[model samples]
Target: MQSIERPIIALDFPDASTTRHFLAKFGPDAHLFVKIGMELFYNAGPDIVREVRAAGHDVFLDLKLHDIPHTVEMGMRSIARLGVAMTTTHISGGSEMLQAARAGLDAGNNTRPLLLGITQLTSTSEAQMHSEQHIAGSLAADVVHRAQLAAAAGCDGVVCSALEATDILTATDKEFLRITPGIRPANAATGDQVRVVTPAQARKLHSSGIVVGRPITQSSNPVAAYTAIKQAWNLKG
Candidate 1:
């Protein structure tokens, strides 16, 4: 696989038509990622997956699946058929669920999707951790522990905050991929994302990929925003 210098533009668009329109603006040579999340997946289903893949852009299916082992296994089997490049599941679902997902992907005998275990959402905060989720321990420590569990469960990678990237890298193997989301360029609005970092910072920390959504998607010129990010990252390299 070619090394991507820029952050992956995860188009968390609402529906299929919007996604199609956004993708149409970019030519075949454009280096970007199309992230299919719950909103679009719920509306358009696997057809959108085909559309994105047919356009020759890598797709990251961010379904964030969390269920029992049997159900997760079945779901992963179905997801594998779509030929997605990467997919996510919640680490909170435990080791059995993660192992089952891995087994299902292996059974498909297709190009296996890079299974990324989501440690914690960027939208979550310390207060929410204790008050809402009732999770114990400091927020950062909890995230690190969950990331370790994900790795032990045989996940290919983990979706963690850029703030925790260095810690995760230290805890896991050097080759272990860390997909960090909630990335915002300097001076950009953080939006709902609580923990954030600039693209250059994430690259310096050895993050495998960065998932960027609204900062690029909601820009006046989406392609320009993406191009700027790419340029910044390339310059860093």
Candidate 2:
């Protein structure tokens, strides 16, 4: 069995107050790996990241930046100063942009965060990709191709679904990080996600890490919900 890392809880709350209230549920001793997405970051700004990190939790700043090489390089340089545990860029940005993003991280921080490249969003279906993006071939193949690009560009990993994690890992390297989102626990609602899997399913699929949202965040008891999902993710085969 592949060693599953700690589950990253998505802090999908609207503002800093709500985010603080939610994180407080885990108590003072709790140390979590939390995701700060675009919505929250746009509302709360980088101070939210600082606040979360000050509380001893690790942050995955999910900006999903996609831009020209120079622009992305500058963006990553600024983000690196936040001292996040991980951050993301779009693999579609191509190798030059990916490499530029890496150079930015190297220039900015002494201890650089793990840079992950986004392959295909979990919300996007194969049909959607075919009709809208006009990308040929299977979505899995595209994801693997992007993962290869990410690896070659010096990225630490790629953000892919559990459905394609093993294939991407096989195509790239076994040690390549496959941080999967769209993780729904057993019997949980799938929400807007199209390529979804349960926590246990993600583990079985050899996902290196998972990003869980609503199930844990919207639950009546957030800490208990988080614990349950983490347990499910860590369950041995």
Candidate 3:
């Protein structure tokens, strides 16, 4: 919830031990908001989630669940049990699925995680959008549409690109959280992400938080890279 350290460091490593090793660089005193995506969560299981929670930091569990309402609801019962601070579902699954997912969270045994609906992945390009998904509307428009649905479903927010955050805010509540990914620091390689922006740009555009993976995780000096990004996010617009 701190304004300065908005980077939710993505723990994209293979397992929890490697995650623990990488995070150890920040020292035992540091408290970070970490992301446990499919690779690490699947390999390390819920014990990894318990370990991360026991350390006093928060976790954003990014499984991007998309399934029938009943199925998603059942899955969320288990996901909510992890007591993560945030979690994601695909808006492409529609409002029924999202509401069911939220209901399951309400039924969960632990603190409710903020539920964010994924609009479109940052790695997805316009070409891929039209060619594969057959969506002729601009990608940003599609993102906004998905975000709108998220709001109607009572979701806490949407996961979109910084490029779309301002536009999404125009249609949704200012308090509705925007969790933007694809944050590549200035001068960093874009990698697989197509709609990347710097942390400063995302903050200026009013993103609630930015999900940064390789920019910090791959750096030789991860703590320094993470610190630089936090400083950038807090800069005056």
Candidate 4:
């Protein structure tokens, strides 16, 4: 997996104007990798992606689509036209749905966006997985299984917690992307995430990329927070 020098900032804002304002905090020379999750995407629509790209940043469209294979395929076709660098779907949707989604991306553009399967959400605790989801295995096992399923279905990578990346990466090839969320710096709040890791921990685990939100986006000095996280992530032995 290619190393992501800069952390992917989550633009978990309410509207387009706020999102734009947040990105502007990094200034014109910063070439950022930003995530437009459900809140922002649903509110701002697809045009916000174009606007961000036009500002010289890469977009990770995090709608996390999960549905019947045909529905996901059609939705992905529409998503492909937006020209994002990455997008996600639920791996629990199974191999057929993953394959269908890939087919749709291939149909839409010669260079499809990176199709990342979400193995397990960071908010889901192991106890919750067993009680609520009624899964029979460890959360790590479940995450690895879903990642393998995604790999077999031709997905480029998976959106997993850094806590599970090592196991998932061991099951898949080196080139397979492991883009982890639930990342907080050592000094940051954990928020609602249950499997949070610091930037240094994620980098040590060899994660392909790390997605961070509040530590940067909600900080009084968003740019400084981002720079601190970036420095931590790139710190050498």
Whole-model Cα lDDT of every candidate shown, in order: 0.84, 0.92, 0.90, 0.92
Listed in order, each prediction's TM-score against the native is 0.94, 0.98, 0.97, 0.98
- Put the candidates in lDDT order, highest first: 2, 4, 3, 1
Please provide, for model 4 over 149-187, each residue's C-alpha lDDT reduced to its tens digit, 9 standing for 90 to 100.
999999999999999889988999888999999999886
lDDT of 2 at 229: 92
lDDT of 3 by residue, 64-102 (tens): 999999999988999999899999999999999999999
Q: Cα deviation in Å at residue 218, candidate 3?
A: 0.9
lDDT of 4 at 31: 93
For candidate 3, the 10 contiguous residues with the lowest summed lDDT are: 1-10
Model 3 ranges with Cα > 4 A deviation:
1-5
lDDT of 1 by residue, 28-115 (tens): 7774676889988989889988888888888889999999999999999999988988898999999999999888887776799989
TM-score, candidate number 1: 0.94
Better of 1 and 2 by TM-score: 2
Give the poorly placed runs of model 2, Cα more than 4 Å off: 1-4
Superposed on all Cα atoms, the candidates' RMSDs to the truth, in angstroms, are 1.7, 1.3, 1.4, 0.9
Which ten-residue region of model 1 has the weakest summed lDDT?
A: 1-10
List where candidate 4 sits over 4 angstroms from the true fold. Answer: none
| Model 4 TM-score on a 0 to 1 scale | 0.98
